[model samples]
Target: MKLLLTSGGITNDSIHAALEDLLGMPVGEADALVVPTAQWGHPMCGPASVRGLVAATPSFRHFTALPWASLGVLELTALPTVGKDRWVPWVEAADVLLVDGGDATYLAHWLRESGLAALLPELHGTVWVGMSAGSMALTPRIGQDFVEWAGAPDDRTLGVVDFSIFPHLGAFPGNSLEHAERWAADLDNPAYALDEQSALTVVDGVVDVVSEGEWHLLRS
Candidate 1:
């Protein structure tokens, strides 16, 4: 399956253009959208968060009607307002799964606790698309030193890919490289340091890097 991964929100013109090129038609064309409610910046309803994002982002705002019509929406939040069974349709019927940015650690824990973690990869035709925390959640490990929105302090991740992704590394607080270096040395595995506007897409086992700035691969 194809996996489209992005660093974070496009804050630059060049980066926005690149993201549009790769994502194609904003998020409106997606077959299914799984937005973690835990990641909403504000305490809004799940559907409201989705609507808010589309409204706030010009690229996504216009496609609101299209996305709602063609795709099923699932809100995986701190707790489900709807039953977990409602998520099956989107998870099972999706050709593309669009994940929004949030807290990686919380997203990971929610997926595991709700039993969706084991079900995601089993999707026969689903193409996974992720951004920021959504991207980080797909990897086996991720740096949580920057924020602790959810889960335990020593939370181990959902082991999807055997690496930690350092999203928005250029914006990491304190010594970014030093912290990354220390994490790499401690984990003894490859770590992805994605700058803002950068992306890493993995499709059918092929990994592609796209960025307007720079991205780094740190290995212990």
Candidate 2:
């Protein structure tokens, strides 16, 4: 699978182009399935936040608002109960998975529990577009600073890539450069700090950063 890990959504032209490159076609020609399971794990997100994301409301214009050939919701929490016969095809048919943000640990749990994580190896053509915690879910760790879910056992995640991420750089209070430095120091591994306009694309085994705004490779 191709990875477009982001702190925010496709908020700039470069990121949008990167998304197209990953899709091998225009976004309008690609079918998309949105994973909103992460939203359920955060205290700041709930019915309203999920609704905004699903509805492509103004606040979420950066994401679901992109013109997709078709759009559908894929609640990971519900996938386990529905059985693979019903949901596997839905996942396989989509060109990309638009994973929204929230709590990485909680999202990791459902991804594994729903069998989605196990299925990733088969989706060689699928592009994974992740935002915030959505992006973090693929990393080895998100660091303690970003843990917002009370139920998470730890900051560890899927580690699909060999690094960590410090998201929302300078966008939110307490998420300034100083905070990212501390976060990266504690991580003691390869890491990046992405502003809203920044994104990291991984294809095969190579990684590239695409940004129109600030981004920092805190650790090599």
Candidate 3:
């Protein structure tokens, strides 16, 4: 599996280069299925937000949002049983899957509920790109600080990656490097704290950190 997990989407030259390397082609030639399902519980989660995100990463040949929320089922098991003709084909056709930031729990719930988690393994060359909450949801578990911050009911995640990510390190309002460090210090599993200009790239089972700003890894 190939993944570009970021605090913010392709925000700088280094990150852009990393993405290009992963794609093995200019981003303009690639198509993406943007999953903004994580933004469901936020007030700013709307068409404009999605548009702005797409605009920032102008390389995609096409960027479209998957309407997972429209289905309305709360349980993860309901997704595979229901037919998702509107988005499934688009997901299959895209070269990348772009996930935006919001509440990690909310995002994970929909990803599993929409059957995207199961379908991911079948997407051989499709790059999984995640930003902020999108990045966090792919971890084995959500860190305590994040669960408390979001008031999320559970810390469970998709477990697509072994380590947990703490995004927007020293970049988010009210968050600082100290706060991230404290959180990482308490985690039993491997953890990473990433700023806006940093990303965690994972290929097969190897992990690499690409950054233009600040980042750190914590392991015990």
Candidate 4:
């Protein structure tokens, strides 16, 4: 499976270029799957803003939020709300899975509660794109120190990779690289802090930098 794990949105030219490379020619080109970790189809969200972020241009496939997943049962629905008619098909017919940015803790819980957490790795044979919390949520643990939210955190994760990802690296002070370094030092694990415009692409378990932004690996 081709995985494009990004720090945040496709806000940089290098990131965009890599994304285009992942999407080959049309027709045989892969379908797209969009999972929003932040806001579900909110107007202001990056996933909702881009043209191919969720679906094909001029037309698309959309699947509205499925029933809350909590354990053993899987919920299936053909109903289309909002743009599901345009969004659902893409999901059903995609060669790619795009995970948008949002609250990492909430997103991780939702995926676990819904049981989609187990199906992530099987999404190979196609491109798997994750941005911001989408990317961080795939790790064994997430950086929750800076986020302010309610409810308990679910340690359940996709485990596609074994690292804690911190988004908005240098974008702010709360979750900056320095903070990540300190946190990682305390935990004594390899941690990566990605800037808003940066991304880390992992293909077949191998990882490499994708953008011009900087990333710091904390030391204990």
lDDT of each: 0.61, 0.93, 0.73, 0.56
RMSD of 4: 8.2
Candidate 3: segments with Cα more than 4 A from true spot: 43-86, 148-152
lDDT for model 2: 0.93
TM-score for each of the candidates: 0.72, 0.98, 0.81, 0.68
lDDT per residue as tens, model 3, 20-108: 89978777677765666676645556667655555543432222322212111122334467577755676677777777777787788
**Residue-level error in angstroms, candidate 4, position 31:** 3.4
Root-mean-square deviation (CA) per prediction: 4.7, 0.7, 5.5, 8.2
Worst 10 residues of 2 by lDDT: 144-153
Q: Residue pairs in steric clash, candidate 3?
A: none
Query: By the TM-score metric, which is better: model 1 or model 3?
Result: 3
Best by lDDT: 2
lDDT (10s digit) by residue, model 4, range 92-192? 45665667655556666667655455555665556666777668667766644633335535443456676667778877757766677776764434667
lDDT of 1 by residue, 35-61 (tens): 544355323225655676545445443
Question: What TM-score does candidate 2 get on C-alpha atoms?
Answer: 0.98
Q: State candidate 1's TM-score.
A: 0.72
